[model samples]
Target: MSEKEAETPGKRTRPGPRKVTPKYLENAALFYLQRFATSAANLRRVLMRKVERSARFHGTDPAEGAQWVDALIARFVASQLLDDALYAESRAQSLRRRGASGRTIALSLRQKGVEGEIIDTAMAAADEAEEKPELAAAARLARKRRLGPWRAAEGRREARERDLAALARAGFSYDVALAVIDAEGPADLEGEGSL
Candidate 1:
């Protein structure tokens, strides 16, 4: 039998013996944040999960680990290393740039544990900078997917209905979708109101 298969249930797969110290947890948090953008709650969840896993392996009290996780998160927040507002703003801008609609951006930030007020502020900022975020996002999507005006003239006629439905499903309003689909060029999309 392979070594893994021969191992007893008590000797299962794990990341070796790890001492779950406060410093270790802090290092873990820093490493995670460095590699990925995450909200405060999400970071807490990740650290807590690590604590639970370590407790299970080492037969230690999870309560102590929980306290360490809380302390570390508090410190990170106080030091300005973990700002939910900044994270939300960055995430919203990324979503908008990727052609996501306003509704989609809000829902995504909510899923990431951002508050509604923060989401509204970020989206408002994006709106002010772009002058009609949803409309611009719709146009970007059309251009990227080669839908609407981006589609060849002969194919545009055939793809009109499908393109409209695609935009609707992507959280765009019918009016914006129709306008983008009927736009003759990029300037047309820019001049049209989002409504």
Candidate 2:
């Protein structure tokens, strides 16, 4: 390309590169943790993604960048700043309160890099405490979305299929979805069922 074409009249150039030193990575890690709770692997993935972007724009070696990422992750883990088990437990509780089914909570935690065993343990704890974890979550979802028992009587009949589909997409089992959809009122869905 000619110099004239390269120097476009109104195009914006990419920003200058930031150095990816250990101190820089540490500061980045601190900032990330302050803003969000994360699993060890999730934190590593976030830091490595930044490193990859930095390497790509600055023309640095990827292997070196990866090493830096690993070192920072190890430091964080050693300091107890990155704990997957804690993250999974906290995340599971939050999801449950927000009307997420056990299946949905597990999937969400797994996607965030939590181990399956940790997810299972956290959910098991929830189940032990709640009469029916899935039922409770489905009830909360119905109330929040104004589906089933929470819906206006005039609209309930028409919205049945759509409400069931919504529950299904949210990871509720067939029986759970049906229970939520068929509830006469929010109180009706408070207990466990044969399904």
Candidate 3:
């Protein structure tokens, strides 16, 4: 029988008389964390997966096997190997840079297990960093989608209203939607009192 297989079941894994080295487990966790930053919750879940597999191999109860994994998490957290706040902040910033709106980014963070107050704060910070795209990008998307070009010649008011409605449906806030849609709209329909 293998050395590990010869161990008695009555002994606790931690500080036990056997050669219990968590070096491999520690290396596995550090390697995973090195390649990518992870939320504390996510790291714990990963450790939990390893614990379950170890339990299956030893015929031990999952809870008994998980003590080591829990210890791993405690070590990692104490060493600052996992930080949920930093993870949430970085993720929100990345999504914002990719053009996600503040509201959308907040929802994404919440789904990632980020707390509501932290998510709200992160999104607020992202908004401060975001420079509204001068409506150019929104206009370009409208042009590509062909949702615009207010037909003022066909009667101004109806065309302006339609353009406004289309931009609203495209996820832009009222101010941004109006600015971009009107930027490409017929001047007569958008600004002048004309038929």
Candidate achieving the largest lDDT: 1
* Best candidate (score: TM-score): 2
- Which scores better on TM-score, 1 or 2? 2
Cα shift from native, residue 30, model 2 (Å) = 0.6
Q: Which digits, one per residue and each the tens of the lDDT, describe model 2 over residues 39-100?
A: 98888888888788878878877788789889888888889999888888888888888899
List per-prediction Cα lDDT, in the order shown: 0.86, 0.84, 0.61
CA shift at 149, candidate 2, in angstroms? 0.4
Cα TM-score of candidate 1: 0.85
TM-score-wise, the better of 2 and 3 is 2
Runs of candidate 2 exceeding 4 Å displacement = 1-14, 191-195
Q: What digit string (tens of lDDT, one per residue) describes model 3 on residues 1-195?
A: 446746876655553222223665677788988897776667767766666666556555666546766788788878877776778888876765554445566677776667887787776665564245324334544555554553433554556777667666555688866765555454423232111
RMSD of each: 3.8, 3.2, 11.7
How many pairs in model 3 have backbone atoms within 3 A of each other, for residues 3 or more apart or on separate chains, i.e. clashes? 0
